[model samples]
Target: MVENAASATGPSIATRIGKLDLPAPTLMGSGCYGSGEEYAPFVDLAGIGGIVLKSVTRFPRLGNAPPRLVATPSGLLNAIGLQNPGIDAYLENDVAKFAERPCAVIGSVAGFSVDDYAYVTERLAARDEIDAIELNISCPNVGSEGETFACDPGLAEQATRAARRVTAKTLIVKLSPNVTDIAAIARVVEAAGADALAVVNTVRGMAIDVETAKPRLGNTTGGLSGAAIRPIAVLAVWEVARAVKIPIVGQGGIENARDALEFILAGASAVSIGTGNFTDPRAPQTVADGLRSYLAERRIASLRDVVGKANPGFAGVR
Candidate 1:
């Protein structure tokens, strides 16, 4: 999405991706701040483009057992299992709060089947405050030999098309880095009607307890997210960005503005703050402000001017 050189009097940080527009590229990653209610007291939510709520399943999930999270050298290893209140409870209890949000609200939905995904999107689309739908298709599909939908192109397309048919709101399909070829999955989802692609979800990894030689995580395996996965995430974003025309929200281990900028350079139109939130609740604001400073120091007025300019051999990605 790179374009002509920036002018000092160009547009502000306000930007657009597909059907949604935002104040800036900064966004809260899913399951981090939980609808921005917790971070609202700390950071100015109005400055961020949107907040991706916790992943919601059709039914309530108890999530993984205790010891579900562990700290690694770079980030956290978590097997939270998409724990959350059932969709019905969320609509009755939390959906209304989105109306009070100062920025766009992106609802994150996780499902085991195409129907399950569609049903959640169907209900969430009814809410006027939900500006977009981010399908967390990283969960295992019951009908697909327990393989995660994000890891399979066919499953990913099915999941995307189901939700796309149910909602006209901006549809973002979150891809998993666990795949052998991320661009393949990204392309198929775009063909299935995804408005944007949240390139690169968490990478799979595990840690073991030294004392007992047992796995640290209760599930024995968990997704690794943080500075460690940032490189991989950037690579995934770059590959998918080059392969697809749809906008991409680059994420994974973005601890600061520098990290987010790396994603932008890799062709991400927007960036999401995840594990960084746990360390600093105001990470989103810090990133947003820092990004502006970066733009100002370079005399670039529009955020789009710098997008994808870092991809080697690609003079520009207009």
Candidate 2:
């Protein structure tokens, strides 16, 4: 019966990440779904395979002060600082609201210390609604711990391994782009028992105010997302896909179906929509539709045909 349901859903976009099997290639990025309620007005949540909830922390975060968002040429800069209602509030209120949706609900988690990651994961493990947890060790808006965890492979490994111990749910470590070598970090996390890797979180960046001669964002620096970072995201996904055996969930500046296709070709088993959601509330559905049309037009039968197709030159291949 389970196999029939998966097959009836049509040519499968579903793929396995660690022990979990995602139902489709399209996943609503963290923050893009915004607690799942925001998407109800814009889309039929059941159509998408999964929805990754916004980043949640141990305690409530008010986030950075005003000017939290800025529009870039093709992307958006945000310094929201992980402002969440905290884990307890989320599991009590938010998770239940979307519990009935057909899609999987994956939580995006952040923390100041290893204990925090374990604490939150343990709490989430008790919930039957969540399908996986994407650890946000790459948040650039934080002052100290967040940035350090991502920049150092050892720290990334420690945080991921700690979270892994507390939960049986699939664990995905979202990586940062502000690193010297992303492949090095990917290797370390995979070794630490990460179920999968979400490559290329927002690249660290800043915008200056001409008149005041000061930084625009209150945090002084923000992570860059959207079209401007697409190429970089693809490159990072390609490199990491080669570096590790685990599946990769790719995101950066994915705005349309074509962009999503690029990531799949680059080796992402799944792709997430970030800044594009702010521009078009239906961006996830649109991208999903686009992927379907692209596949049909090309006479391709399954998404597996495209995953890692671009990395033809990968070592050991003739």
Output the number of the TM-score-best candidate: 2
Compute the lDDT for candidate 1: 0.83
Q: Put down candidate 2 lDDT per residue, 1-318, tens digits, no spaces.
A: 022253344455656766666556677788767867777888877667678888989999899897988888887888889989999898887887767767777888899998898899889866888888999999999886787888998899999999999988889999998998999999899899888889878888899999999899999899899899999999998888888878898998888889998888888888988778788888877887787777777877777778899886332111
The candidate 2 region of ten consecutive residues with least summed lDDT is 1-10
Candidates in order, TM-scores: namely 0.92, 0.94
lDDT of 1 by residue, 1-318 (tens): 222122224446666777887778877889777878888788877767888888898999888787878999988888877888989999999898789988888999998888999999999878987889999997432223324788888889999999999999899888888888998898799899999988777788889989999998887888888899999999999898878888889999998889999999888999999899888887887887788888889888778888888876323332
Candidate 2, residue 225: lDDT: 92
Q: Give the alpha-carbon lDDT of every model.
A: 0.83, 0.82
